[model samples]
Target chain A: MLPDPQAGGQTGSLEHIALLRPLSAEQRAAVARQCRWRRFASDEQIIDHWADTQDVAFIVEGRVRVLSHSAGGREISFTDIDAGELVGEMSALDGRPRSASVVALGEGALLAFLPARPFRDLVSGHPELGLAVMLRLCDKLRGATDRIMDLSTLGANNRVHAELLRLARRGRRQGAAAIIAPIPVHSDIAARVSTTRETVARVMSDLTRDGLLQRRADALVVCDLQELERLVAEVRGAP
Target chain B: MLPDPQAGGQTGSLEHIALLRPLSAEQRAAVARQCRWRRFASDEQIIDHWADTQDVAFIVEGRVRVLSHSAGGREISFTDIDAGELVGEMSALDGRPRSASVVALGEGALLAFLPARPFRDLVSGHPELGLAVMLRLCDKLRGATDRIMDLSTLGANNRVHAELLRLARRGRRQGAAAIIAPIPVHSDIAARVSTTRETVARVMSDLTRDGLLQRRADALVVCDLQELERLVAEVRGAP
Candidate 1:
């Protein structure tokens, strides 16, 4: 596919994908030849949970969220995969059905689909690529474990504080503060941390009132990251 | 290490370990030469949380529980790894400190320790072995995701029900029934599903009174597996 100048110059090239960066130019070219390209509009369903598809998607542009819905119709958002990252490899490796649904986020997104067989072969044939995939899974497992610990041990307020700290770290840093522009929606944070929207709102207001958080035009600032971290660690123990 | 015929004939051979089973016999033997063996008494610590060591442990005999304690001194047991499985690989792969403490569960436990460097070399050098480990990690990530969904959507009572369904499936089968012999401790179940001992006790009693669960001389029998599954699925929706 030709590079889309309008779509931030996304060429669907294997070179830009984090999982394939270690490959030589020729190796990457071979992999790119095996991959098919697709573009998704914002909020479009890129991969449905239990769809039985085994193709792995490498994000070439924009972000996608991995999420699932409860029987009660509540959505549980797992995590976001950004450009240069890949998704759908678990099923590719294990020959299992899709474990969760993935949806493109914001504006438009570009993805390269590599069918399961070729993906597995590529990983097995390349030592560095295999290790890279292993490292990515390691990071995902660690993130999941941390969420489990928080869900098992912490209260709602503390969980909210943890989520804010996480978002702040991903946001812009000021002089001794971190600003989360267009601050994350309360309900979204609630879904991630397994809390209620009201609880998240209450926690946010309390933090703002206590001067631990600040609300500016289009941004929410974490005034004291260390204090917020201490509040979580108090109950979370030494980890 | 010699075959401890008394210790269930565990020879600490790589042949018996699931992760390395995909490797060639010669490859396994070569990898075995680089491993060291260790044994731990019941309730003894195997890997302490935050420890800097990075040796991956393959469980050859007995079982161990991976756990951590909250600042309140409440223990949160993550999962139990049985013989033929492995643990401590996260730190081995990422060079990070141990994520959680692992404790031996029975009279004695035998483990084969492969240092971080050799373990990484073993995985990256062997394609089949690497794929096997990736599959194992995929299972773990799916499990963690399921736990996250349950925690985020289900309440304490429902969580307990879900946990019981999980245990029942792992228990011994008796025709259409399932028997969890010596039934899990209420407090331990409490830690696992993030509930209180009282809540677990109350739920058990409720299930027993309703005839959905029965207490036998040495086991907790799920009288109707389908019904128990239904109860959980009522809130859990579909898999």
Candidate 2:
């Protein structure tokens, strides 16, 4: 059975989390005790569109897609949330309904925490925590703004290349070759890049032929960072 | 002569403005004291791109265009700020150099306020004030995101029509006919919609010929909003 939600023990350490680094042991304990781990199968709905849920979750494992739908049920993707990123934060902060839906891309685990009132009270007691969360929100906003600009201004090929570069950077660390194993499906790439699946497939084929990337089992591995960066720069009109 | 930046006294009232209604008298006075009124000639630069100014300004009169430049110095416009709209709030929040340049479309007047530290301090002291600003920011983010989706997903003509409907809503109130005068130049619309000028012009002409809009001296007067909304629904695949 799952542990009691009201248990007062040190639930887990929060120090290892990048955003929670400044919290004290006691505060970390408070946060960990409040958090509940939940699992979802592939394609499970973690949050429904327009639902009012004050709980904020951190992805502990696997991936999820954030998306919106039209009245006629056409889907438009916003972003993909990877492990270690916070989800449903803006809704929790503003007490608003979810603006988009979140669905697990595969079997995933999330550390969900609820009742923003307690969280706000904790932040009030600890101003540093509030500031840290605000800074994280600002960083997310900056990224969303850049993605909007990219989608609006860049062409399909450049957008795909940039997305590959970003995924590589996120999947690998400094001095280690970035690996984006088991290439994302063409339709998934199209959704993220706001292009058609055929266009994405064409671009991928071209990139493979140019020797900038290699095809793995259901994945495309980026083999040449220099070439990818060069293509991006050329598209962006960089020197 | 311009008023002294440090001089504190009575100033113009912003209570009549729709967007400023949430602000209290004390808050208005606090903001007004830090404000300096500036006048600009036609085609003058109101805010330079990449400048380090941290002041947020309000347009008391006339109009301003927010535009960005690529690394190669190619300019793309985002939107226009008309009378009574807040300008430059994003820069104030981010503390970064201006993301885009603002230019006066005609002779105009703006109330520039200084020392964002004090304004932010005021917000921190008054959570309600901060909430109001946050709501406005959220609204702007939603609009920008929607525009990005439109540019990527909609055809050129559909984008032009959607833009017209957006402008009509902003320029008109409920139960009132929208008398949108001085429609933006076709070239400007092209930039904002992320399409070619010729395409924008062709679409606008077609819209006028279809009786959806009537061309005026300086604007395109929207005649039938219901029809335009229907077109938008059809294009966006709504029920």
Candidate 3:
């Protein structure tokens, strides 16, 4: 395995692989060599469902949406991945058809890696690397399970608020109110919350009117994080 | 690695790991030696959430429930695994915290395989085994993704019918009108479909009275599979 020389030695490191923590210097070097940086424009299909290709990606920068569509045109966005998060691990580990479609939400860079036959041989030959990959997949599964539980129990309003809070935390800047850029369209919010766009629109309008959030030039400014968290608590039926 | 003594060297052979297809003699022998059989009684917790253990299990007999709960006591049963299917592959592959809980529905037998280190080493050492496991995981993930989509888009009635059909296909015995034994309690169904137990009970009673199914002494029996499928289609809003 050779590291992409063009990456200028700034490609994503093993630390980005959060599930496989505490890597030694040698192990980090080995993994870093296998990673190649690739960039995608906004709205580009980073991973296509039903494609036969076997590339797995870890987001180095930007956001990617995990989406599914029904026969009747109903779309559901199960989750999103941002900087330092992993995607395509399921297809990479399982070698099956991609379960859903993934698209870049904006310009983004990813560390693309493929552990084909040679990689497998490497894993078998190097138990530590194989263990790291396995652990990483486990972390992905754990996160997915939590998302499933949340979707099952929480209502759409709560789901929206939780997602907003998550995005705010991810993109927060020091000493500045959290500003979520490229305010997601109502349809996108509908897909994520598993509700109709009309419903999402109504809720967003209500929130805007109530001074909880403000529509900005290119983003949605969450004026009060505490208020959002309180709404989440209320949705969870907390006192 | 040693083959099970009781199985007379047939253990882990192509015949044993039938869910994994097209295995070579060498590959079969390798898998056989690495396999271990175990048993659990009804309601036994086969896997606990967040436990530090690593073993992938294939159900040789009986049933198992896959479930998760929220901090506030909400429970959801994603699905149940019956004989011939594998469980714990996600945890086994990643070696992270267990995402959910698995409990035996009845007395069950399983062929448990060790920490992914050995099997993955085996796979990396042997491409055939690695490919076989990948394909199996792919199939499972596909099914899981489809179920998630159904839960997000379909109504409660459709969810129940689809689950019943799934159970019938997997649990049916020869010429017995498809007995779905040990019917899932109403609350379980409610959680699975994101509805209330009262709603689920009312729907079940309606279906029973409509002659599509029969509430048997020991199990729920689908009298006509076609009618049940039609009911599911109708509930899904099919024209």
Measured by TM-score, the strongest candidate is 1
- The lDDT values for all models are 0.87, 0.67, 0.67
* Tens digit per residue, CA lDDT, model 2, A99-126: 6789988765444454666655554454
Residue A53 displacement (Å), model 3: 10
Encode model 2's per-residue lDDT on B1-239: one tens digit a residue: 33423354435554444455577887676676677666676778888876779777777667888877555554667777787776776566668666568888866555555466765564455554555555555555556657756766687888888877877876754343465666777777777776678988888788778876777777667887777888898877633
Fnat per candidate: 0.81, 0.23, 0.29
Give lDDT: candidate 1, residue A149. 85
TM-score of chain B of each: 0.91, 0.78, 0.71
lDDT tens per residue, model 3, B155-225: 67777778777777766754636778887678877767666788778887887888877887888888777
Error of 1 at A200 (Å): 1.5
Error of 1 at A179 (Å): 1.6
Choose the strongest candidate by DockQ.
1
lDDT of 1 at A168: 87
What lDDT, from 0 to 1, does candidate 3 have? Answer: 0.67
- Candidate 3 chain A: minimum summed lDDT over ten consecutive residues — where? A1-10
TM-score, structure 1 vs. true: 0.94
Query: Where in model 3 is the C-alpha error above 4 Å?
Result: A1-66, A79-144, A175-177, A205-212, A223-239, B1-41, B50-63, B82-86, B108-123, B171-188, B234-239
Tens digit of per-residue lDDT, candidate 1, span B1-239: 54753455433577888888877888788777677777788999999897789999989888999988877878888889999899999899989778789999977788888899999998898898888889888999988888898888889999999888899998989988999977788988998887789999999999999998998888999999999999998898986
TM-score of chain A of each: 0.92, 0.79, 0.68
